[model samples]
Target: MTATHRTYPLDESVDAVIIGTGAGGSPLLWRLAQAGLHVVALEAGRAWSDPSADFATDEVAQSKLYWLDERLSGGDQPTAFGANNSGIGVGGSTLHYGAYVPRADPRDLRLHSLQGVAVDWPLDYADLTRYYQEVETFLGVSGPSPYPWDPARSYPLPPIALNTAAHIMRRGCDTLGIKTSPAPIAALSQPYLATGSEHRHPCVHRGYCHQGCRNGAKASMDVTYLPAAVAAGAEIRPQSFVTGIERDPQGRITAVLYDRNGITERQRCNAVFLCAGAIETPRQLLLWQAADSTLPLNDAVGRNFMAHVSTQVWATFPQPTYLYRGFPSTLITEDLMRPDDADFAGGYLIQSYGILPIMWAEQVARSRPLLGQSLVDYLMQYPHVSGLGINGETLPNADNRVTLSSEKDARGLPKPHITLTLGENEERIHLHADPTLRAILTAAGGADLWISRRTAHTIGTCRMGTHAKNSVVGPYGRSWDIPNLYIADNSVFPTSLAANPALTIMALALRTADHFLQQR
Candidate 1:
């Protein structure tokens, strides 16, 4: 369905006021509005009015899709925030996300119950199993049928064809007796009509998934849920940044205060869904808490932050690997998802990776001291380089939190000060992954290895759990302090599941919306 561009009165109380129309907010808005509730989504940035026409494949040009707002960072490893993690605009980070939509393993959700480390999620995989299928179907996720994982299911769309790099990775995995499968991604492998006549075409494999898909195939929320929500009678107010939430004396949220075109307006609502993402979600809460001295202290609001151990091991192969020609994650292996010999408490996933020219060069320059002819010659070998990446689970650290920074932004709102450091489990996983990835590539006739340390998919700042005292929100995403408020984004993830977070966030968001509807 195309956008109806619905509008709602500011002072008139609506059924729900959703902040940020990304993966979380968009899905819920579509659901609530389709169910005949008055819903409005307030986005901090402009909507991709026509994504196919507006989106460009150029990496720097597509930077507008990212949330580049000022965010203070400090820790043993200060986290990278912008395009690598969060996005603004109507689609949120889904705009520039790599679109690798892996489902969380049952072990990913119940890590605490299985290994006695990291708190288990309030709801386990069983609770989210159906939602996973729903999200996959809605996104038209392309993957191998009979997914080779626990609690497996067939995909709605066929797997995207593997590129040269994936072939080499598969060869190595095959020789090493390790299982490999085509990675699941939200990008369509075939033409699909997800909602109404919104026809999504198959991916052309331009391999610019990180730079935002110029075609209407990646299933970014802008191309799917946001417009569907608008068509379903939801009001999408772009450039409206929510700064404060108002509540009654009984601790029930009543209205949302936001700035749209420099004018502050109070949007009265019976309930609010905060889906601004990991950094902004907690930042909004902390900012609200800072202004109100009477509000009870909730140290748990920004505690236990986590970023997956995103380490990429790149190798130059004798044969052309064509790293720039396919989806970044074309192939995956769960062989190490639960390794018995690992010192780390949890496991990690290995994926055959792709990289564009500029980002690859940046990594090369950051990792090595090659200069002049040496640098040019090494860079010239780009087509022969293949990469294997690790998306490892991270145990939460209370000290790894998002605190209010003294710095203020253009809107004078307190910036989110994100402090995150790798714990022992993550460190050990990195150590294991580095050698393992090197071995896999080497077995496939690769050499000149370089490993880049990184993190992606920020999560768990406003974690969901069984109780409010120890967690930021309840299992259904309702806040314990504010009865009518819910957090339906990555911020509500209890742990950083050892996979990309977009699919799970969508699943959790749908579940939260379903629960909200069930209660109504």
Candidate 2:
């Protein structure tokens, strides 16, 4: 079914207002609404859950769901950063994400205290671990505890069955002495039970996880938190574009003012939650400060950003692997994700999964010739060819940040400008990934392998810190400058951990929601 298009007039008043509706805002909306707060969630994008039309395919042009459509961008920003990559739809970036929801390794939290690089998190893994479990229960994540490579935690559910490529990768790891494990995913490996809801069944391994889950098998925010928030009487206003936050002379947030398409509106609320992702959240704060003279913001609102530095390694197998038949990612290895003290550079998992035919073709076309008639010939002769990737952490650098570009959008707001260069520490970490990646590929019996430098996972523009002087949000995610305003998203991370960021983002939201509940 196509997404229903509707325009909702903005509400004038609400107890609390949350912005952005992806991993961060969606769960917070549910939690706050369930806590009996009169909440309103504003999403710049519309709701899209149909998998048939949105799945990764051969089409040259894609639906709005295929890419992030928010007005906030980095095209005209002062810095040379790429445009923010996230869905503008109701579920936010969760709509287009590959649902590999691995937990942030415990070592990732101690970056400052241990390695003396970035600032340390006010809270530790133990503090946020329970909330991680809470999100796992709500999302029905499937994976084994203690994926053989790193430290262990009890998964709420078991791991999904490994596909052929994963199995072969596992074999390669075994031969090479590198441990392997099932990739943690948000999709249901089998039927799972929620307290008051029916059991969600398993995925059929359709490799369409990115386009949106058709069978409701992938546990996206739309299927999990949005419904729960609506059930709890939370009002969600999609297509509502928030412009600036209103504050009184006393410095407390008075209301959230926004517009519906082109009409102006406002919502008076006791509190505000800025759940917009890294780029937009910081941009919004910067815009507010630029527009208003009275808001007391230090220089840290848009500083110290860090996006995971990632690279892909493609390999050609000797047999028919059909890597695209199952989930987008089904296996991962944490061998490289050690503490900064290890022999290797502190890195994260090596991920391998299938892509859509066209995307695969595009990749081949852009990188090398591996598709079309040559690809068909290669597949017929040696169908087991596969690909893998390395997503590693880059240390937080104040210079690597988000800024407002001089160029204006259609509405005249400055697009996000990004100036990012991998720090020396991050470059060292990437250098260590080459040999490890080669080992994994060689062990898997791949003949000729290729590697490229490109990462889609971006994070850490507005991190949480002990002191308000260096960070945008306090330990509890409340903005130090704005008493009634809080931020919950990947932006709150002090350091990008060695894992896929979705689960960690949800976990942070759950943890922040708990803090909010305690205050109530």
Off by over 4 Å in 2: 1-12, 49-63, 66-85, 149-152, 196-199, 339-345, 361-384
lDDT of each: 0.86, 0.74
Candidate 2 lDDT score at position 242: 84
How many angstroms is residue 358 displaced in model 1 relative to the true structure, after the best TM-score fit? 1.4
**Model 2 Cα lDDT, one tens digit per residue, 392-448:** 887777876778878787677887776667767766766777666777778878877
Task: Write down the worst ten-residue block by lDDT for model 1.
Answer: 290-299
Steric clash pairs (candidate 1):
none
Model 2 residue 353 CA deviation (Å) reads 2.2
Candidate No. with top lDDT: 1
Q: Candidate 1's residue-wise lDDT over 1-520, tens digit each?
A: 3566778898889999999888899899989988999998999999776666787877788888888988888899777888678898878888888888888878878888888998899986777889988888888899998988853589999999898878988998888888999989889999998754278889999888877787878989988887778788899888998878787898777899999999999999999999988888888888888877665546799998999998988889887777777777789898898897888877888888888888788878977889999999999999888888889998898899999888888878777789988888899999999988988998998989888998878989999988768898999999887778899999888889898898889999999999999999
Candidate 1 — which residues are off by over 4 angstroms? 195-197, 371-373
| TM-score, model 2 to reference | 0.89
| TM of each candidate vs. truth | 0.97, 0.89
Listed per candidate, the RMSD to the true structure in angstroms reads 1.6, 3.9
